[model samples]
Structures are given as C-alpha cells and as structure tokens.
Target: MMTEPAQNTIIEQHINLDDVADLNDTNPLELLVQATGLSKQRVKDAMTKGAVWLSHGKQARPLRRKNARLRLGEELHLYYNEQVLSETVAKPELIADEGDYSVWNKPNGVWSQGSKWGDHCSISRLVEEHFDYNRQTYVVHRLDKAARGLLILAHNKEAAAALSAMFAKRTVEKHYLAWVNGQFPHDSITIDKPIDNKPAKSIVTLKEYDADKDRSLLSVQILTGRKHQIRIHLSSLGFPIIGDRLHGEPTQSQDLQLMAYKLDFQCPITGDKKAYQLKTWT
Candidate 1:
C-alpha cells in the first residue's frame, strides 16, 4: 500500500509591486529578489517549490515557468506555509459519492477553497488530489474555517450550478449544532435581522439546557447565507456560542462549538430527495 504524503507547514505573505516603475518588464525572479531582499538563488528555490504567486486584481496564478516577466503594479504573494509545502496532505473523509455530487465531512482548519496563499490545504485541492482522474471538483457551498461537518461538492459544472441554485433558492435545509452560554428563553426562536444590509433569518431550537453548567445546546437553521450569520444572530440573542472567540467572550477553549449537523435537500442533478446527518458535540 502507498503511504500518504506528509503535510507541510505553509507560511504566506503579500507584496505589492505598485510603485516599482523601473521593475516593469523585469524578470519576476529579479523583482522578487529585490522586493524580498533575498538572494536570486533563494528566490528561485522558493519559486520552484511553488511558493511564489502573481496576482492581477482578483485573478491569481502561481509562478512556475522560468524567466517570467512582471508587469507594472502586479502583486507577488509569497507562501511560507511550510506545512503545505511539505508532503503532508489533508485527506477529507468522503461521506457519500453521488454520480454528479458528493458529501464529505469538513473538519475544522481546512479551507473550503484555495486563497492567495495556496490550494494545498484546501478541501477542493485535497479532493482533486484524492482522485487520479482528470475529473475536477467544484465547491457547492462553504463551511467556515473553524466550523466542522457536512460539505457538498460537485463533480462537474452542471451539478455545481444546480446545487448552488438550490442554496440560493432556499430549497436546501441546513441545520447546525452549537453550545451557547446561559439559558435560552424559548424552546424555539427565530431571529430575523438584516445582515450586511441583506435579509437574514435564523431559527434556533433549544435542545438541552444544563443548569449546573449554565450552558444550552441549540440547533440552528439559517434561511439566508450571510457572512457570520449564525454567530451574529446568536450573539444578538445575548447567548453567544461557546468557544466562538469572535462573537462571544473569549474562553479557555479555542475551538468553536459549532458544527453543521444536518442537511436536507433534493438532488438537483438526480431529482431525488436526499438527507444527511452527522452527530457532533452531542
């Protein structure tokens, strides 16, 4: 059997080449050396190891070819995440493999997609690397960096668009589990608040309340996809999720006590109703 490769620690930083007028049309290697104050050979080594990236506005590409030219005002991003640079790979546990779409349990610390740094630690990249076929994977939805559990991906663009549409149309039902500080007032409550100037709704159900612990376990369902919707809504209710450092008061635990617990939706590609559940923090 083949052993999985070792994961690398990836470090990253960004440098803007906006004011370097003389560096226009100069070789990327030369500019990177000047920008980073590293030797040409060191810069070359970093580039060869897949650490250097070039960005033009929202589009970013890794620098691979030798003697690549740098356009004026282009951005160079250096990835120093040594963990990602190493052979260590993060393998996502595949839950179910549909023909056009699949479900996987996304663990905390794994990105849903690639960023300016690299794709090595991203779920999309990991999923693609897991398979040998030229077939690609597309992200249908995203789970937060600190949140865990059910994530769906599409094998092709058709499935991607369909699944994404389901989310946008509110045809998909998503439930999350969380532990919050203090006792909640209602057994089930709805939070209807505008998030980022967009309509956002959240339904929260109190599953359990421990008086001795002064904590409540909740099931949350979001009706809109807004950034930090659950965290913001729950905190607005004065019962912030435990371990949520950003929304709640800092606790000794650094792990966020939130997980995507269940999902129910019709398969846009197969036209079959589907449901999935994964118990977390129960």
Candidate 2:
C-alpha cells in the first residue's frame, strides 16, 4: 500500500493486489475501502465520478465498477479529491433536442469534458445521466469552464464525427459576447496574432458601451478555435475581459463576462441549416 498525503489535496493511493495473497479475489471497492479508510458509499461515488483507476501493464484508465476483479499483478489507484467530489454544479438547460445531436446551455463552472478528477460536473456526463445512459453521449465541441453558453452534444458516434469535422474545418459560425473594461476604441477590429505558435484569428465589434460604468460590451467571432483565443486577443488590444483573471486585468467580480452566445451550422445528418442561441446576456 502506497499513500500520498492528503494535504487538503487529492489523496492518491496505489494498491498492489499481488502483495496481499489473501486479498487476491477481493473486489476493487473493498481494496480501496481498506486502503483509504473511506466508507464504501464514498468509494462507490468516487468510482462513478471517475476518480478510481486500474492498470495491468497497460495504461491506467478510469474504473467505475465495484465488482471488477483485480488480477494478481493488477494495480488499483484512487485519486481522492474531496473538494471536487463535494462541489455542486448547476444543471444545464436543454435548448433543443435534435434526434442526432442536442444543444445545451452549460452553466458557468461546468466543464466541457471530464478529467481524471471527476466527470459528474461535465456537460457530457450530465447528458449521459440525463438519458439514463440509454443513448451514447459524445462531446462534439467544448466551452471554457469559466465561460458558459450554448454547447453541442452528440448522441452517437456518427453525429460526433460529423459535427467535430465541421468545427475543425471552421464551417461552424460561432459568436461570443464579452464585457470589457473602459470604452472600446474601435467599432470593429480583427486580430490574427498567432497564439501558442498556432494561427488564430478573432474579430471583435463593439456591441454597446455603458458610459456610466465605463464598460463596453463586444461581440467576438473566432475563425480558429484556440485555447483562450478571445481573451488573449482582447487583452492585447488593451481592453481585457472584465473577469478574465488569467489574461485580463483584475476585477472585483470573479464571474467571467464571456459567453458563447450563438452557433450556426448546416446539420450534418439533415443537411439543413441549424442555429442555436442563448439570450443569457441579453
């Protein structure tokens, strides 16, 4: 039994089944329970949330089943992040249910996909549980966890492939809203600066300006989807987003004033144009 100290952080532990000959036929849950001194219910929840893992010579992968038998040389790992497991995520609203795909208004702080820590707070996992796992859920696109708005979820693999291609090819028209500090200098501007040594472009237009608050609301469209593209571009232009802590000027509000407000694209399955928009900012 190897243990990583829980310094108010993720307590990682690895258990080798071969060492304890008597525990050879024991289930993964029991091993985790005895190793971590956590209750069975807590271990079960951790497994379901993707905090547990198994490895047998191959790469480690998340394990969710309790009854899975551990092989003689197999290893069971637990990443117990109490904070991640206890935090609650707001439910996303279903905007439209296309038979092949669906649109959802992901709330702020809800992740686009799951990490090794957990999946319950991710939109894709929520969609899977929403359908009772009857339909296969796939993530077609993603939004920043700090920024929330319309996101697409595919029910099957075919839809996922088609929609993913559209986004990769930049055929999908994406629109975003951001509130920035002070009055914007231009009505419209385009930034084509390379981000992370990758070609990325973002177009910004002044939507409205609040004279009293000295803030400007801007409309942003990205030609290439790069990580933090909009925030980086806007900050370079001198008007960082109001709450973009990473790339923007500091502000009182912790909530990021960014939203993926609209998405328009030709339906891959029906060949019909479809648009989804969120009036959250309006």
Candidate 3:
C-alpha cells in the first residue's frame, strides 16, 4: 500500500524563466498591491518585516530595498495577512420563474450585489452571468451577507419597477427563520416599528426550543421590507439571533443565524401567486 505524504512537507523546486516572466511585466509593488489589496505603505511595512521573499530564496530584510524589478523566472512569495477577495459568484438554484422575475435560494455568506469594481463575489453578478444580457436585472430587496434563504430577482426594467413597488407598498409577504439566544416568553408577538419612515411589522412565532442551549427557534413573518428589520426587531426583544454579530449575544461567533426562508408575492405580469421556500437549513 502507498502511504500519503506528510501534510506540512514543503516542496520547493527550480522552474524555467517563461513560467514567472509575466509577473515581471508589472512592477512588484503594483502586483503585490493588486494581489493582496494592501496599500503601498503596508506593502513596504511587510517588506521591512521580512514578510516578502524573492526568487533567490532570500527573505526581504530591512536593509533590502523595496523594488518591483525582477528577472524572468524569479519566484516571488508574498505573505498577506488579510482575507483574499473572492472572484467567483454564488449561484443559487432557481426556484420560481416568471416572464421577467425569478426567485432563488440564496445561501449564507454571499452578497446580493457588490460595488462597481466587481472585486467581490455577489449574487447579482451571478444572475447576470447566467441570464441573457439584453435583459436588465435588479434585486427587489436585499438580505444580509450572512443571512440565507429566498431572494427575488427582476429580469427587466418593468419587472424591477413592479416588484420594487410591491415591496414599497408592503404587498409582498416575507417569512424568516431564526435561531435566537434566549427562550421567548410569549407564543407569538407582533412587532410594529418604524424603519426609514416605513412602518415595518413582524409576527414572530416560537417554533422549537433547546433547553440546554437556552435558545429558541422562531418563524418570523414580515409585513414590510426594511433593512435588518427582523434582526433589529428580534434584538430589541432581547432575543437576538444566535451567531448574529450585529444583534446577537456577544461571544465568539460573528455570523447571523437568521435566514429568509420563504417569500410570497403576486407576479405583476402573470397575476399568479409566486411562492418560494428554501429546502436547506443550517
């Protein structure tokens, strides 16, 4: 039988010039900054700290200058102490579809959209990449990056306008599931809070309980769309969602345990009930 190699073994080798020549085409500082998304000063500081390594198998010392110049086949090892930007988009399965609108099951840790540079992975980019370019796409609403569950997308301008109006008008029904920190006192409670001049209402129903963990699972229905409405409302009730950084009981976990589990809306064009439910639960 063959034995597997040790995990910590470091394998180093000498390669031909053509392999790393493209790295020399750009300045080292520029390449490092682009690769690590660090400022020039930070890169220089790393160099001073012996964090940068050259092809000659030499660690960059303080006396060593910070230059971008390199010969062909020179190996560059950069030690970055930051999270690397994700380039791939999270593609959720399409649940429901209309002429110009569709619903998807968005998983946790995926952004709904990103900034102009497209430096970060996002759901919008994923949809755009999968759909026809002639059609315009827009997010009718947003879910927190850490929150999972159902999300609605509009394929064209008309669909976007209609769905946006539905959200603004409070015609769409949104339901969520949250694993909260403490036991809820009441069986059901309605929260009416003003969010950004819009009246937001949520009906929370306790579903399950874990006595050992002192936690309760809740089914939350939102009558209005507001940024962090469910999370904020639950937090205000003193039973913040477990693992929620913004509102949860502070410990070590920073991820929110809330999920947008279900969405029900009337299709603007088809006039049919558009309901989407998430099959996966974490």
Best by lDDT: 2
Cα lDDT of all candidates, in order? Answer: 0.79, 0.87, 0.69
Q: What lDDT tens digits, residue by residue, belong to model 1 across residues 37-140? A: 55566556667555789889988887865587777657887775444544343467888888687898887778887654456667886777667645688998
For candidate 2, the per-residue lDDT at 101 reads 88
Write down the TM-score of every candidate. Answer: 0.74, 0.90, 0.65
Model 1 residue 276 CA deviation (Å) reads 1.1
Candidate 1: list runs displaced more than 4 Å. Answer: 1-50, 54-60, 63-90, 132-134, 280-282
Better of 1 and 3 by TM-score: 1
TM-score of 1: 0.74
Ranking by lDDT: 2, 1, 3
* 178-197 per-residue lDDT for model 2 (tens digits): 99979999989999999989
Put the candidates in TM-score order, highest first.
Answer: 2, 1, 3
Worst 10 residues of 1 by lDDT: 1-10
TM-score of 2: 0.90
Q: Residues 1-282, candidate 3: write the lDDT tens digits.
A: 323224332222223334544754665665566555556775565454334556654533111246656666455555533232223445676777675877877777778875322213567656665674455568888888888888888988888988888887878788899988778887999999887788888999998888998889899998877888998898888888888776665564656788888878787777888777776565
TM-score winner: 2
Q: What is the C-alpha RMSD of each candidate to the true structure, in Å?
A: 7.2, 2.8, 12.1
Candidate 2, pairs of clashing residues: none
